[model samples]
Target chain A: MQILIIAAIICLALSFFADRGKTIAGIKRGGVMLLRILPALLLVVFLVSIFIYLVPEKVITGYLGSNSGAMGIVAAALIGSVSLIPGFVAFPLAGILISKGVSYTVVAVFITSLMMVGTLTLPLEIKYFGRKAAIMRNVLSFFGAIIIGLLMGVFF
Target chain B: MWKILDNFFLLLRETIFFLPLMFLLIGLFDVWVPREKIERHIGYGSGLAGMFWVILLAVAQPGPLYGAFPVAYILYTKGASVRNIFIYLGAFSCMAIPMYAFEIGFLGVKFWFLRLIFSLLVFVSIGFIMERFVGEDFRVREGR
Candidate 1:
């Protein structure tokens, strides 16, 4: 934490010395970007909080909780692939699910796949990477997410 | 109001603690470097240099695949090769300049380093395969 603060301060100081005008401009621009993103992030967090409060841990566990077996892993991965929750929300939620008895493998697969594979974002990916490239990357990432789950199963 | 205040404070705490330095670097890049320079230097085609440039951009950019997906779509539609796309996504998934700086701050250097290495490996491996097998016809259709 101290290191990060020091780094930010140093970066800020360097920007001040190097080019105050540009530095100020960059900070201002970055601030604007943050503003644009923050609302969505907050809304998601708020909704998830409500979900955590309302949804029974047992229900989540039954579907995706730890004891869920091979089918559970597949279910968790599929849920993650489609869900667009940000990492901030995903991590805490995973913790909650785990406490409720969801397997570590299921949670790990869900989070890894959530970050890596994106069936929901496929159109955009295709637009950028081309159909073949986008498809292949997602397919690979999908499998990769599973591998990560299996690895966690063995180690954790 | 108290709850709102608490949430805001929590968010502020997270931001202060975890925001990556990479973000600042990205800000610097945006402010100091010209977009044309990025494109001219890293613009599509096959080869090691192109791949390197793609990785640089991916690492530098922050945000989820959604943001990059559109850009990638645009680039591919315009004729960016499969190799470049692989590089872009690879970089995007792995590197996040601002967020990473924050992460290192909050999570520690070790975690950040591991993530960096892991993401790079995943991206590079994926790029290699796409370049090797994916055909060009799949390139983004022009202007659509």
Candidate 2:
């Protein structure tokens, strides 16, 4: 909240130099842009809320253990791809997975996929970058996650 | 009805908080920043310097993936190279600097560094591939 205020104040101040008229116009343009993206952003937020709160944690951790093997990696990749939990939550959750004997490699895949490929944001991504770029990036990152996982297994 | 509204209510606070601020910045940029200025800095001839420049910017920002989309589209319109913009999004989501210290503490130094290195390489490759796949005609004015 403080950060937003600071940014808002700075923008207003800077706009004085940029042009008072243009700044007001900018604020209006910003409002319209906000409205344009609102529906899609809300959809993503809703999906993230459901996936995080509704899905059983045990189901996730259980299938993601080291002994869980290929399926474990796949499960981790799938969950990580969609769940847009913050870094604090995600890293601690990942650490717990490692401690619980989940494969380090699987955890690597999980974190990599979680960060790089936002499956939930596909609508917004497609709306901006178009279908081919959005789909390709996600698809490639999925495989890249698997490769990183395999490498981690070999190295550590 | 209850379930749907329940979910909506749950996320309403955050949506109200962040979206306007994001759009405000975007609006400011839209109004003030010159297209030629952006194009020269991060556009076609900018080369590796542009990728690194954008990565630094992406790392400095602390926002979710959706936030990057609009900023990226703006950059693209203003003449950022296709590949570099994609790399920026990749770095923004994958290896954000705000999250770096936290990541190292939890994931350990070796693990974090390894992921960082590999993710950068993968994203650059992805960017080039995307550049080829989408080609020059993908610009906003051309498409519109």
Top-scoring candidate (lDDT): 2
Q: In model 2, which runs have C-alpha deviations exceeding 4 angstroms?
A: A1-62, B1-44, B140-144
Tens-place lDDT per residue, model 2, B11-96, is 55634554566567667766776444444454344587778777766765446787788778776776788887788788888877
Off by over 4 Å in 1: A55-76, A86-112, A124-133, A148-156, B1-29, B32-35, B43-45, B69-81, B105-108
How well does candidate 2 score on lDDT at residue B65?
80
After TM-score superposition, the amount by which residue B115's alpha carbon in candidate 1 deviates from its true location, in angstroms, is 2.4
> Against the true structure, candidate 2 has what lDDT?
0.72
* Model 1 Cα lDDT, one tens digit per residue, A1-156: 677667767877888899999998877776666556567756655665456556766777777765667889998889888988765445445644555688777876786688778898888666655677678889888777676677666745
Candidate 1, after superposition: displacement of residue B58 in Å? 2.5
Between which residue pairs do clashes occur in model 2? A66-A102, A66-A103
Tens digit of per-residue lDDT, candidate 2, span A57-99: 5665567765678898888789889888665446655664565
